[model samples]
Target: MTEQVYACIDGSVSTRTVCDYAAWASQRLSTSLTLLHVLDKESYPVAADYSGNIGLGSQEQLLKQLAALDEERAKLAIQHGLHMLEAARERVKSDGVANAGCMQRHGDLVDCIVEQQGDMRVLVMGKQGAGETHPGRQVGTHLESVIRTLHRPILVSTGTFKAPERVLFAFDGSQTSRKGIERLVSSPLLTGLQIDILLVGADTVEHKEQVKWAANTLTAAGFNVPNTAIRAGEVDEVIQHYCQQEKMDLLVMGAYGHSRIRQFLVGSTTTSMITKSTIPLLILR
Candidate 1:
């Protein structure tokens, strides 16, 4: 069966961008796409006791007005959620992606979505939303934790909506990267995709052998691969330049799963790709 993709919708411009990308992936990977939007009320904390204990038992007019206003606010939020779901569903359908649907569930948004991550192959979400990122997260809220929590790949968007033409696959020969590359090789979604396989490290003889192992494997699998190896500069900087030069549309990378990875975000390479790339990124954990 084709893998399933879960994408979050927040009724922002970026959400539309994310939806388009997800629909494309769904069609490309031959997978199902779930458009999820959560009505979050529990995550955001509110003031409970303001300035001592304010009694409300005796106030007739004040209590009634407050209750009415609260209900109005809730209705408005629900209305917004409905409109967002409909618009997103239309976008997904227009993209020609099948097996797609809209969801307007409730609860802590991240928590609700995270609950569904177990069965999903990837989670696509925007870097920012509704004029701000999620609270207590990275520059793009929920991205860091989402990556950390899920074993699946999480694609952090650049807010750019376009079909991917070229992909930069960062190679380290790590086990995680091994699985990532294997997925690429086995999947038909990348049948004719152009990949710029980047091998970055010291220009030592041993590293060249590592690259050979990767190249030979990919060549055997029938991929049109162009390669580059740079022994200088940071990983992020090198990737940015390559993206500009090659006009890379997406970045394919592996997730961090080791302690050596802790010194850098979940995985230094994954974090670097998200922070630096001017294009969208697809991570495989």
Candidate 2:
């Protein structure tokens, strides 16, 4: 079975940006694109908060009315989801993706992804969704959960989509980072784009050697790999500053570099960097 790129389309302002990025990826990788819209079951709940001193018949009537309202809301939700999916499919198709398709699922977004994990080569979604109170202010509520649950590479879109001409790879010699480097070399997603290998904080001899080895590996695979090591300031801060100063198109890194305890209590570098980034992030696990 051929792998397809699944682009999640919430009715957020960022939905179009996600579709643009998905189209770019689909064209580059020569893969089919699927625009997925998931109508969250939890979003529509029957209201039954009738604790007044009313008669039993009145209470029953209220319950029936509430159930009817819930049914109407559910129908509207499904219609909205279908409309969103159709719009996303047309947007991606107009953006140069020839084989774009759409799917509408009724459940949690993460559950839907789990059901379609086998054929998924990559997952694309907006960092923030329409349900968010503030736009582009924080990460989407489902973003972290989807990353933790799914093993495929995820592309988190932040702003308008531009074809990436240069990409920054954050390498720290961990198993996940090594896997990211290998993916970069083998995958057609980042092929033909200039790459920069960066190592932040505690630039020891071992760190330098690791950076050198990574650069050589990428160079041997016919990539324009430039290397840099920084031994100052916080890791996320340094990386964000460098990426902004250089105007990089994308930030690539491994997800969850530290232990689970630290990640749960104090947040990981992956989340921090993504929160501070203005460009899109291509995360590998």
lDDT of 1 by residue, 1-285 (tens): 455988888876578788888888777778889888877775322223232324655675566666566667777777887888788888888888755867777676667766786668778887666546442123355566676777777776765688876778777756656666778888765667777777656677776776677777777899877775645456667667877887888887666655222323465454455656567877666
Error at 191, model 1, angstroms: 2.4
Candidate 1 residue runs with Cα over 4 Å from true position: 1-3, 42-55, 133-138, 259-275
The root-mean-square deviation over C-alpha atoms between each candidate and the true structure, in angstroms, is 4.0, 3.3
Model 1, residue 175: distance off in Å is 2.1
**lDDT of model 1 at position 188:** 66
Per-residue error for 266 in candidate 2, Å, reads 8.9
**In order, how many clashes per candidate?**
0, 0
- Weakest 10 consecutive residues, lDDT, candidate 2? 259-268
| TM-scores for every predicted model | 0.85, 0.90
* 1-285: candidate 2 lDDT, tens digit per residue: 889999999899899999999999898899999999888767744343554634677577877677678778888888888888888888998999866888888778799988988999999989886787667767777887888888788999987889999898877776657767888889889888899888765768887887888888888999887646545566677778889887899988776567321252135554566667899988775
